[model samples]
Target chain A: EPEVTQTPSHQVTQMGQEVILRCVPISNHLYFYWYRQILGQKVEFLVSFYNNEISEKSEIFDDQFSVERPDGSNFTLKIRSTKLEDSAMYFCASGTTNTGELFFGEGSRLTVL
Target chain B: TQLLEQSPQFLSIQEGENLTVYCNSSSVFSSLQWYRQEPGEGPVLLVTVVTGGEVKKLKRLTFQFGDARKDSSLHITAAQPGDTGLYLCAGAGTNFGNEKLTFGTGTRLTIIP
Candidate 1:
């Protein structure tokens, strides 16, 4: 079965550095999403994208965060300036229908030093 | 804000045992979904319940949505090693379905072999 795939399974970057997390969602999926889970915490929604634009975002998704579908297959989350609090497991997911049965990739562990 | 709280933050069971994880909240939801996440991996969707008092089954797993749509539960029968993982429940406004997913803190289950 087609699944979401994320690259750089682990990322380590210093504070104030820029980092990009990449994901290639299942082909033909119409909606894309980014979520992060702090160690021992709930998975929090970062943002959602559809129709090539952001549909919604959470407060955790602030100025430092941005998402783009640079090409037809790649969806990326960019952190302009990383912070200690930004260290978390970032997951990308996609769903073909509005029913919200999302398929998630094995997350990319981002460690902000 | 919608919040789904999963009970028994951690649970350990012997093989062939039955267990149930509960997800509850004070707010109503349009639909509820259950997901399982393994270490270092993103959550994999298990089942989604849409209507009040709805029930869904996947293999030895059973999922139910509360009558008020404010809670859900996942029950595993004769669980195996493969059933061990972090279980999460997400709720969202029905009308805005597929727009966003609000998640719970998650319940980590360990089925001892």
Candidate 2:
């Protein structure tokens, strides 16, 4: 089965640095989303994208966070300034319409030192 | 906050034992999905229950949606070591709201051979 794929399975960056996490959603899926999980915490919604624009975002998604679909198939999340609290597992997901069943990528672990 | 409260945060069971995990919410959802995640990976969808009181079976695993569509449960029968993982539940609404998912804290299962 086709699955979402993410690059840089693990990332380590200095605080205040810029970092970008990349994802290739399942081919032919329309909606994309980004979620984060702090160690020992529940997964939190970051943002969701459709039609190359952000459709919805949570409070955690602030000025430091941005998402783009620069290409037809790839969705990317960029953090302009990384914070220690930004260290977490970032998961990318895609889904078709209707019930919107999501398929998530293996996740990109981000560690802001 | 739209919280998904999951019961039994951790479980250690012998192989061939049965287990059930619960995900409850006060906010009604358009659909509830169950996912199993191994450490260091994103969650993988196992089943989705959209309608109230719906039940779906995937081999030895059974999923049920609550009568109010506000809760769901995952039951595993005769679980094996391979079934040991972090089980998560997510909720989606029908509001054209980016189709983002609100996830549970997850239940960690350890099956001993």
Candidate 3:
């Protein structure tokens, strides 16, 4: 089965540094999303992208966060300045239909110190 | 803001036991999905329930969508040790072309052999 793939399985960055998480969604998927889960917390929606632009975003997706589909296959999330609270597992997902059944990547664990 | 609450955050049971986990919300959803996640991995989609009062069975697991579309349940019969994982329920709203999903708090299950 085809699955979404993420790069940099684990990243450790200092406070105020920039970090970029990359994902390659399934080739035929039309919708993409970014979600995060803090340790011992529920998974939180960050943003959704379609047609090469963000369709919607949550409060957690502030100015410091940005998502780009620079190419047909690559979707990337960039954080301008990482904060300690930003430490979490970031997941990238994609779906071929609007039914909301998404396929998720293995996730990128970000550790801010 | 829409919120999904899951009951019994953690459960541990012996193999072959039957168990149920629930996801409830005040807001109605266009669809609901169940996912299972193991440690150090992203969530894998288990099932999706769209129509209200619809039931779907995957092997020994059965999923039900409430009549109001605001709740759902997962029941596993004759569960085995392989059933241990963190289960998450997510809901998608009725907005056209909106693919953002709101995830529930999650239920961590441990099946003991």
Proportion of native contacts kept per candidate:
0.75, 0.74, 0.75
- Per-prediction RMSD in angstroms? 1.3, 1.2, 1.0
Q: Ranking by lDDT, best first?
A: 3, 2, 1
Worst 10 residues of 2 chain A by lDDT: A95-104
lDDT of 2 by residue, B1-113 (tens): 67898988999999999999999999999888898888888888898888899999999999999999999999999999999899999998776334788898789999999
Write one digit per residue (lDDT tens) for candidate 1, span B1-113.
88889998899999999999999999998888898888888888888898899999899999999999999999999999988889999887655546688899899999999
Residue-wise C-alpha lDDT for candidate 1, range A68-95, written one tens digit per residue: 9988889999999999999999999998
Candidate 3, residue A60: the lDDT equals 95
TM-score of each: 0.95, 0.96, 0.98
- Position B32, candidate 3: lDDT: 94
DockQ of every candidate: 0.73, 0.70, 0.73
DockQ, Cα level, model 1: 0.73
Which prediction has the highest TM-score against the true structure?
Answer: 3
Model 1 misplacement above 4 A: none
B-chain TM-score, candidate 3: 0.97
